[model samples]
Target chain A: MAELDEIIHQPLRLRIMAALHALPASTGLEFARLKKLTGATDGNLGAHIETLARAGYVAVDKAFVGKKPQTTVTATAAGRGAFARHVATLQEIIAGKQP
Target chain B: MIDSQQASAALNDINDVVHRVRQSRIYQNASLIIVMWGALVFVGYLANYTWPPQGYTIWAVVDLIGIAGSIAIAAFSGIGPGAGAYALRLLVAFLLFIAFGIFCSAVLGHFGPRQMLVFWPLFTMLFYALAGLWFGYAFIVIALCSSALIVTAYFYAGPALLLWMAVVHGGALILGGLWMRRI
Candidate 1:
């Protein structure tokens, strides 16, 4: 309950997780593009990524993309594991009570 | 700029609509594919009755194959969300069989086994080529090769067209499976 609660209870972080989880590895701008695609602002997206990084659900690395500060982010193995568990819980919710 | 929340909500709505549309298409196409196939069978039956071969029961066999093939398609459901795409491959394979049945029935009245069998591999090469638009070259090549082998082996026997068709779909399965790897 706590983990699933952690995953879906937050709005911006949920969007961040969902977007990156849906795609292959992506940079901050790519994540930003996804956020833009998914309808989240730069500030909101950055905040969520930080939250996920703090929670060890995401890992961020700083680098330069064409001389511009590029922050690359990926779901950590733990984060992916947590997301899978969260999804199973979601599926259980959709299925409604063990048959 | 669009409101992020609103855009997200709109996209969610769009996803829902797309989901419904896809379900509708699978259902509608299930029926449509059967009806189209049924029409083909009906024609085959008419040909059987109208052009009664008397000695050879091949027409009756062709008619039965047509009915059975269409029913199989309806039963298969051509893939769905729960099962992923493999079931679709089966459905498509059945469809290729249905195509083969049509080809067989068309020449049922007169064409011999050798000539009849040739249609599958050569044309399936083309069919798979066109399938390349939807499926690609590996699938096309697999279909072409498989169909050719079956036709070659049974080049002398009964309706060998189905083997060629098997290649079309066998290739599709092999190719579709590989293509799915990239995705």
Candidate 2:
């Protein structure tokens, strides 16, 4: 039986992961756009993103865009694999194949 | 381990976020196209107003430019290998739309200049409203508001109909495109 990923099981992190995964591969979303998509506050989102980053599930890139600091987040390959398994596990549980 | 209910809820959350992301992407891409067309329409109407006898030439040029720009935007915005095909399909659809409009206004109805002025904007808005049924509410709202304004101008503006269209029709699209980005 497969288990849910503890790192992504958190609600805000799940939302963040979902948003990033929805984009085309290698395409990252800006920090502001991620926050808007997840509806998370700055400090809260920053903390959750740090957790995912530490788990090697996401990559964060900081750069300057036209004199403004910009941060983008993308799901790593491992992250995508984990997310897919997590979703599958969730479906299995819902289908009564797992506890 | 979570129960089935909790798992279901979690999946629902993921689905919700995915839907929002898809809609957000669509809004982002569509806003740029809408703004470009809005600017072009604004200029086209102003040129038509200034040069009454050159109206046909002005509109033909505007339509050509707007279609080209729209296709370019779609091509650049699209992802992966399907972009070219998507752009081709869009071009075909646009041509078909224009062809139908010409058939109605010029061949069958023989609308005068004033009727032609109102007809095209209203007709385009009808498509926008229909697109909203599949895309989102923003298109519908923009279409309805712009159509209402165009109809109002048609009945009331009398002598300055082109100027009124330049302001309301063009102005609404610009404003709506900006607003769509915010949403």
Candidate 3:
């Protein structure tokens, strides 16, 4: 049986990863949009995103759109793989194939 | 180790977030299209009001631009593979819809200029409302509000009906598109 990813197991991080995974590969969500989707405050979302970034689960791109700074987050290939496996393991658990 | 119940809850949460993301993407693409149409119709109405005799020419130009712009947006929106097929399908659907409208207004009903003015907006809004049954509530709200204003102007705006439509129909769509982006 597979184990749940401790890094992704946190509720907010789980939500974050799920949002990124839903998009087409390499497409990123802006920080404001991600925060709105996940219902996280700026600081809280920033910290969780940092954690994901460190885990190599997501790539963060910072750029200037005109004079304004913009941040976009996308799931890396490894991140998408880990998220898929995590979900499958969860499904297995629900199906009584795991403890 | 988490139990089945805990795992189920986690999966449900994931599903919820995934749904939100999908809806957001839809809103993003739709908002652009709506805004483009709104601007086009705004100008179309003003031009029609100014050149009453050339109303047909002005509107034909406006509609052609709107359709072309919408197709361009769909193609460039990064909808992934089959985007060209999707665009072709969209153009076909639009042609069919317009054909049906022409059949109803010109061949079957013989609607006059005033009736034609109101008919097209109402007819399009009806489709928007129907699409909302699948797309989201924002479309329904925009359609309903715009239709109401158009109907009101049809009865009450007198000689200024076109101007009223420019403000109400065109402005409502522009505002609604902006609002959809926030949602």
TM-scores of all candidate predictions against the true structure: 0.35, 0.96, 0.98
lDDT string for model 1 (B138-181, tens) is: 44554555565545656443443344333433444444444333
Candidate 3: pairs in clash: none
Q: After superposition, how far is residue B74 of candidate 1 from its true place, in Å?
A: 35
Residue pairs whose backbone atoms clash in candidate 1: B132-B136
Which tens-of-lDDT digit does each residue in A8-86 have in candidate 3?
9999999999999998899999999999999999999999999999999999999999999999999999999999999
* Candidate 1 ranges beyond 4 A from true positions: A1-3, A24-29, B1-183
User: RMSD in angstroms, candidate 3?
Assistant: 1.0
If you assessed candidate 3 against the hidden native complex, which CAPRI class would it receive?
high
- Scored by DockQ, the top model is 3
Which structure among the candidates has the greatest lDDT?
A: 3
Best by TM-score: 3
How does residue A14 of candidate 3 score in lDDT? 98
lDDT of candidate 3 over B5-56, digit per residue (tens): 9999999999999999988888888899999999999999999999999999
Worst 10 residues of 3 chain A by lDDT: A90-99
Backbone N/Cα/C clashes per model: 1, 0, 0
Model 3: DockQ score? 0.87
Off by over 4 Å in 3: none
Candidate 2 stretches with Cα past 4 Å from truth are: none
